[model samples]
Structures are given as C-alpha cells and as structure tokens.
Target: MAIEYIEGDLIASGEEVVVHGCNTRGGFDTGFAGVVKKRHPAALDAYMEYHRNGGLVLGSVIWAYDGRLIGNALTQPTYGRAGKHISYAAVEACMQSIDDAARNGVPGTPFSGGFTRVSMPLIGADRGGGDWNEIERIVETTLKSVKTVVYVLPGHRPSADALSSRPRR
Candidate 1:
C-alpha cells in the first residue's frame, strides 16, 4: 500500500501528505473554525491548504452505542486507550467529509476532482469511549467500499521503546 503513516503534532505535520490526529480545532488561536475565521489569518490559510491538498478534516462528534449515525464520533484521548468505540455516527461523519471533498473537487481527486490521497486518524476510539477493534473494523469496512487511499497515523511511541515494549519482537 502506498498508504503511509505519520505521527506528530498536526501543525508540525501540517505539510504532511495528510496529517491525521485529534483536536485540530484546538490548534486555532481563538479556537473553533468560527473564531479562527474571524481572527486568525494563518489558521484560515492552513485550513485552505488542507482543503486544497485533499485532507479529510474529521469534525468533533462522538457516537452512542447502537446509534444510527457516525456524526457523534469522539475526538478526545482517554486513559491508556486511543479513542472511543466506532459508531455508525462516526463512520457517517467520515464518509460525509470524503463526499464533501469530492463534491468540492479538491486537489487529490483526479477522477472526482478531489485529492488522490486522504489521511485521517483513529476516530471514535479515544475519550469517546469506543472499542478499537470495532473502530478498525468499521473503518476497514468503509474503506473496502471505496477506491480512496486512507493512511492512518501510527502511535508516536519511539521505535526503540516500541521494540522493547513488544512481548517477543
């Protein structure tokens, strides 16, 4: 898979092929798109750049168990876990972002006039209190139905630490 993983602060990785993670809105000076739109010029530029480069901006929202939509996916970190459970609400939100990008004719999508590559983070599996496996399964299932590239960010744990931490690597 040409799909690559990146791990770092979203701003530091702003130029990433596709930066992925949580709390994107927090990075804004005044916080939130509405506030940034009115106050931060650079924030707007970064957002435009992200859109121009075909980034998938997953908004804040967490889904409930047995929910009908993925619009309420969680974006907070909780405990030792990465995120909350993958809910139908969360997946719907992601898919909607993709659809919006395609419709807007973003850079990466040559066929649909959208970016060819899309980068996103592990959603709904952190503080939102969702299951990792379920989230992975939901994302995988969604990806299987599409022809887009979705590169996920891996844990930022250092290589040496990861190797030493592994059971029998």
Candidate 2:
C-alpha cells in the first residue's frame, strides 16, 4: 500500500502496469491512449479487438500486453461515450483494473507474474469532465487495501500541479 509521485511520462514510468482511462468503444483517439496507439499499435489493436468482441464494459478492465516498453496496459472504461461526463463508476473501474492485474498476470507473458506497481494518469479528469477532488478521494479510498504502489501522472494543465501535490491517503 505505497504511493509515489513522479513528474514524467506515465508510459515511461517503468511500472509493471500502466493504466489508461478509455471509452467503452475502444477508441484511443486522445490523451494517454493516443500515445499508446502511436507507440504500441499492436497492443492498442488487441484492445480494440477485445472491445469489438464484447470484452470491454464500464467498470471492468482488460489488459494490453506490450513487450517491455511499458510492460503492460490496463485499460479501464471511464465513460461509455467519448465526450460524456464521468461518473464515480470510473473509480470502481480503476479499482477493478488493479484487482484484475493482481490476479491475472500481464495478459500474455509468463515471465512477469503480477503487477507490483502501476502508473496511471488522472482518471476521468482530463477528457471525462470529472472533478479532481472527488476523483482523488475515490482513488485513495479504492487503493487503500491494495499492496501495489500506484503512481498517478499529472495532467497537462495548470491545475495539474495542484492536483498532483494532493497528499496520498
């Protein structure tokens, strides 16, 4: 149950799992998903394929295995539509992703067992129109019992500095 903050790229954070907030339709059009799509097309493809096959749903998580670049991706649905307002369910989805990673290894690799640490951007706050205070509270509460160390990436806005500096619960 440890948390650390580092001001850098979430994809380059070197954690076992990198979590991204995605839409239910599996579109990586912007934000961290766009970076992932550009850097690891294969992983993004797999995620979309899974979504196309009815694998992704709100409040659930799916993994995208990318070899070593960032270990693996844990995609959680933050909203059903791209520009819709976010809900507290996004927090549940994030917690579920962490729990899933702890149970299932990094999706396709045998060498890596389970995630010991995870890096994530501020879920639901960027494009999902969520309040940072509420999202932060939800994150801290949900991750309280988990043993994995979580690294939350700051958003690319002026207020991100204030958000990142919030004390971990």
**Among these predicted structures, which one has the highest lDDT?**
2
lDDT of 1: 0.37
After superposition, the stretches of candidate 2 with alpha carbons farther than 4 Å from their true spots are: 68-84, 110-112, 145-155, 158-161, 164-169
Task: Write candidate 1's Cα lDDT for 41-140 as tens digits.
Answer: 4435555455466552454332111111112222332222344323455455555554455345434223335433444444444334556445545544
Candidate 2 lDDT over 1-169, as tens digits, reads 4345455576665654566666765667777678878877766776778778987666655555656423223333443445545657756656765655555655556424665556666666667767756766666656653443334444546344454476655
- Of candidate 1, the 10-residue stretch with the lowest lDDT total is 62-71
The 0-to-1 C-alpha lDDT of every candidate, in the order given, reads 0.37, 0.59
Candidate number achieving the greatest TM-score relative to the actual structure: 2
